[model samples]
Target: MTFLLLVLAIASEVTATVSLKLSEGFTKLVPSIIVVAGYGGAFFFLSQTLKRGMSIGVAYGVWSAIGVAAVATIGALFLDESLTAVQMGGIVLVIVGVLALELGAAH
Candidate 1:
């Protein structure tokens, strides 16, 4: 359950971040609303996951890394942003680091 909540939080955060770019410095109304609500809900669920058994450092690290990667991917795919090879490699590294942290926490 905690893991599920963490995943949801990560997804919500990613969505919020992507929508933020669309908000155009808050000049746009609808995307701005999504950004606000999405972040609020994401944090609420993240807090709940922390209250469960997940360590703060681990949970936050994983959530942030995943959120960044997801947001970058969305930007590249939907916004037609170019993701250079180096950027893709960096994202892979972030995923690997998160996996390493999860494995370390398991033991």
Candidate 2:
């Protein structure tokens, strides 16, 4: 299903972004490879989902927004990155935007 593929694309993109940090500036071979492959698969599947009827603008907006949020969370949890209150509020806004986009696409 297109929805499932879209979800996979978002997940793969998030995984790839997290792996990018683990890649250590691409010095670590394995993590670097994971980043490359994960992003490749994500885009490939996203293309398929688009072909399956989802609007490109809506799909890309949701994907990028969710990917950014997930990667930020991963950085906070695993990399011990500090998220200021303002940054946290920004992430919440991104989520709200994604939800609004999805709702608009439903009509």
Candidate 3:
């Protein structure tokens, strides 16, 4: 349940980030609304995860890592953005580090 909430938070954050780019410095209408709502949803869901007792260290680490990777992938796929091999490797490392954090947590 907690992890599910975290996933929601991650999705919301990613949506907000992508919409942020579309917002064109808040010059657009619909995407700007999405940016505001998406961020609001992200924080709301993230807070729910914390309230459900997920550790902040683990949750935030995973949230941020996954969000970065997803956003980068989306950017590359649809926004003409590019990811270098080095950047890809860094994404993998971030994910691995987050996994390590999760695994090393006290059970």
Candidate 4:
């Protein structure tokens, strides 16, 4: 359940980040609203996960890493953004680092 909440938080954060690009420096009203609401939902769910006893370090590390990768993928797939091989390698490194953190926390 806590992990689910964390995943929701990461998803909401990534959505908001994508919406931020669409907001055009807040000129667009609808995307701006989505940015605000999405971030709010993300933080709220993140707090819930923390309250449910997930460690702040592990949860935040995973959340940020996954969120970055997800948003980058979204941009590449839907927004016609360039995702170079180097960036893909970096994303893989981030995932590996997160896995290391999770594994370390298990001890």
Candidate 5:
């Protein structure tokens, strides 16, 4: 249940981020609304996850790490954005760091 909530938070954050790009400085109406709603949903779900006994450090680390990776991949694939080798490495490192946090929490 907590993991599902975290996934919802991550998805909301990623959607908000992608909508931010599509919003074009809020010039577009639909995406702008999505930006607000997505962020709100993200926070709400994230809070639910924390309330379910997940540590702040682990929850935030996983949420942000996965968000970054997903947004970057979506941008590169659909928005004509570039994802360089270095950035890819950084994403990998972020995921690894989040994994370390999760693992460390298990002990």
Candidate 6:
């Protein structure tokens, strides 16, 4: 349940971040509202995940890393953004770093 909540939190955060770009500095009403709601839900679920006893390091690391990667992909795919080789490598590194954190936590 906690893991699931954490995933939700990450998704919500990513959605909010993407919406932020679409919001155009909060000029757009709908995406601006979405940004607020998405971020609100994200923090709510993230707090729940922490309350469920997941370590802060693991939870936040996973959440942030996944959020960064997701947002980057979304930006590139839908927002006409560039995804250079260096950016792709950075995304891979973020995933790898998260995996290493999870592995380290196991023992």
State the C-alpha lDDT per candidate. Answer: 0.91, 0.89, 0.97, 0.95, 0.97, 0.95
Give the range where candidate 2 is weakest over 10 consecutive residues by summed lDDT.
Answer: 65-74
Candidate 6, superposed: residue stretches over 4 Å from native: none
In TM-score terms, which candidate is top?
Answer: 5
Candidate 3 backbone collisions, by pair: none
Number of the predicted model whose lDDT against the real structure is largest:
5
lDDT (Cα) of model 3: 0.97
Against the true structure, what is each candidate's TM-score? 0.94, 0.91, 0.97, 0.97, 0.98, 0.96
Residue 74 CA displacement from its true place in model 4, Å: 0.6
Cα lDDT over the full model 2: 0.89
Give the lDDT of residue 2 in candidate 3: 92
Off by over 4 Å in 2: none
Model 5, stretches more than 4 Å misplaced? Answer: none
What lDDT would candidate 4 get against the real structure?
A: 0.95
| Model 1 agreement with the true structure over 1-107: per-residue lDDT tens digits | 99999999998898889889999999999999999999998999899999998998789989988888888888898999989999999999988888888899989
Model 1 ranges off by over 4 Å? none
Model 3 bad stretches (over 4 Å): none
Which pairs clash inside model 6? none
Ranking 1 against 3 by lDDT, winner: 3
lDDT of residue 62 for candidate 5: 96
For the record, the alpha-carbon RMSD of candidate 4 to the native fold, in angstroms, is: 0.7
Compared with the true structure, what per-residue lDDT tens digits does model 5 show for residues 1-107?
Answer: 99999999999999999999999999999999999999999999999999999999999999999999999999999999999999999999999999999999999
